[model samples]
Target: MDERFEIFLVATPGLEAPLAAEAAALGWQPVVGPGGVTITGGWADVWRANLWLRGATRVLVRVGSFRALHLAQLDKRARKFPWATVLRRDVPVRVETTCKASRIYHAGAATQRIERAIAEELGAPLAPDAALVVKVRIEDDLVTISLDTTGESLHKRGHKEAVAKAPMRETMAAMFLREMGFDGSQPVLDPMCGSGTFVIEAAEIAAGLAPGRSRSFGFQQLASFDAAAWETMRTAAAPRPAPAQFFGSDRDAGAIRMSLANAERAGVAGLTRFDCRAIGDLQRPDGPPGIVIVNPPYGARIGNKGPLFGLHAAMGAVFRERLQGWRMGIVTSEGGLAKATGLPLESGPVVAHGGLKVRLWQTGMV
Candidate 1:
């Protein structure tokens, strides 16, 4: 219960650098770690991060850690630990535990012990499906406790209820946009946009909108939460007019409708446009050159990979013929698919998306 606690910003693997960069840009000096970036901050910092950071999948506040040789010691320390400072008695909590290289190797037993300690001392109800979660990790006999301040993964965004098959997570889309050096100053286009994730995200970023503005956070239920202060923080950023338009096109009319609905719910419909068109029929918008980002169907998700070559080639032909001076970011699992584009693409880091390892293939002004 220190004034400033360690906050871990979890990122999708292979996307740590961009997330770290974002944290630094937000005035936090984060130390990059295995699965996330760690920074020292208080409860208010946690709230702000959950509200502002688009790349973070979840925010975990490291409450405390202690050396526990056995479950008895763990239970005693957990009972004494200042749970009142973080966990509210009125809210329910779920305790999850992991034991590694320790005598207390039974994760279930350790979870029960911590659960008993919290219920007995803090008077908080324990439930199997509670929004608040206490994560305990016992590694090398060191018990580290953390709280998941992001209830339903940050990707939910509380707006994009309509999703297409093989839809991209908002968190990953944000990071991918960042990777393309999208500062929201220029236009963005998704030729094969499914559910319009990239286009909607770009429009929102251009409007200077907070990703979590439409959502509620788990931190609001914590004991240290200050309602007035949180309200001030969440509404601090005034939405601005986008510099340019964002566009999305899909062959499926259903996908186009879903994109429009999703954009409306995200409050970025004014800055975005969606159409039903095949890649070959896509025409560049009337504006200066911008970035073209698309998450096209891959072999794993959609139909056979054999015929995709022609589709990719057609996409490349359209981009080369119509989208000159426009940069490109293509997310696909197969290198042949990207190569078939014939756009002189250079591969970036490989990312894990929906159980398939995909890479961002980038091309300088096509």
Candidate 2:
């Protein structure tokens, strides 16, 4: 169970840099790549990665790899794999395959071969909807097999049940916070706080709460899982006080309601505040000015940027007049809309979100 292997932390495409930085800060030797970060460790490290990483979409363990130029070779190699050491015979498993510049170019055929090998050789039941997934990649005649150790996506967080339209995922929100130089000491405010993602994420970080504290992961279903050891690791994360307050507001009363509910479910309601008001009514909180981040409507889906541009300009004016000392981060798809903020902003990475590409613009000080 302590066999060292490659652990891949899947990032949200453009957010790979921040995710790698986070892994490095956690004392892991993170190697940055295109879609994720790579670290090497054993099963305990796998559990810890699932329990600690807020920016990761999922965690995968590369258990084995070999050269298989054809379907028969792939089948023979997969049958010879030590699946019993990594996968349970009783737990249902799903196999997904992909081919890139490889001799085994048919993904469906590869999937069938792997599934047959696991089912007949290892006697593990195969199901399409299984929680435990075995991922296969045939790239350049090399067959790489990995296990999806983090199930149900880390963004679920096992807390918030309700979500608003185009709501930002918790993982993305967290990485975005890291990009803005947040260190849990300064307050965070989100005016268009749909479902209170940013504010609640900030509060959790400030309070030293593990993002995966309330959730279950796919690693628990693997054969290598040790229940007692996992319990110790999961329960080791202790919470601390959030030094500064977090604030969220929205013009829609229902949005504010959702925000309040989400904050409460996330156990950060006491440290966070949600108000129903227009952006114009936003006033800087009494304490020290901290950071203001907003995910305004991109208007790309609506096919209209006229009103959105005006809204951005108005929001910018309100920030200039009201929240004078705070820094700002604005996320939107339209360059026109972000520029309309009229703040001295520098552009960050372009991230893929819900089929649309969005960029984060950061300002030094309002």
Candidate 3:
């Protein structure tokens, strides 16, 4: 395989900007485009992106591409491509196909051709439930092949076994924290901290911990993987102490228990605390003020709107009274419900989370 190829960092719709910013800040000149931020590098870049990028859903290496205007041409090209350079003959892989503005538009037929090419020619077994996936995109009559270098979604994080209803994903929470101007130098508190995702993400950022430290990635199974070099890169940086503590609170005792357990599993229990308390009972901790980010129950997700307005209004009052001088971010499905909080909040772009369209409402200080 060539030492250089394209690495695509997949982002959810409307979130490609922040992910690009993060990639650029991490020293890669990222090209912002639809589907993701793309960069050109080698296998090490693939490994590093999976380890360092918290906002990407999965990192894909665009290995090769070709032009095929018909099904027979695609079958011929697929059989001749150099899959053995990156894919192992022993590892099993699954094939998925998508066609856009292409003459050869039978996606199922295309999938079959590639599957047979790899299975029969490359000597790799094809399985329906394989961990590795070879994604084929036929766009503008050009066949683009990419390997899913990230097996599971990056949000898994290999920790946080417990999850609450309508839970915020770790990837979204991390990007939201960055959007709220969090730099890991101040405290972070989540009032409705379900499963402690926001708090754990904040604490991890503060401690300079890599998001993929506790997990293995699909890139490790690729033929080009360099174990010694990856190990050296992974262990070169040690985690440092957080500048300030992180806190989470919830009305449900079970939620608090879940938060504590999740934090412990994430190795941030020493820098975080979970309390079983209502929003009304929340008081500022004795430290420098920071960001207050919360993902409260959305009316659409819960099938109840009557109580939510009141809940938001009450929560707004609590923030006004107790959380002054702290910047606030609230994630909710309805703008009306978020405005009911009555903070000086401006709306961010709509993000798709847990099958619901949600936005992040932010304020200067509260």
lDDT of 1 by residue, 47-161 (tens): 8899999999999999899999988998899899999988999899999999999998999999999999999998999999999999999999999999999999999898998
Residues 1-366 of candidate 2 have per-residue lDDT tens digits of 658999999999899999999999888999999899999999999999999999999999999999998999999999999999999999999999999999889999999999999999999999999999999988999999999999899999998887998899999999999999998999999999989999999999999998999899999999999999999999987899776589999999999899889888888889999999999899788798889999998877668678888889999999999888899999888888889978888889899998999989999887
Give the clashing residue pairs of candidate 1, or none.
Answer: none
Residue 41 in candidate 3, Cα distance off native in Å: 1.0
Runs of candidate 3 exceeding 4 Å displacement: none
lDDT tens digits, residue span 205-262, model 3: 9898899988999988899988899999889889997755799999999999999999
What is candidate 1's CA lDDT for residue 98?
93
lDDT of 2: 0.92
Error of 1 at 319 (Å): 0.9
Q: What is the lDDT of residue 249 in candidate 2?
A: 92
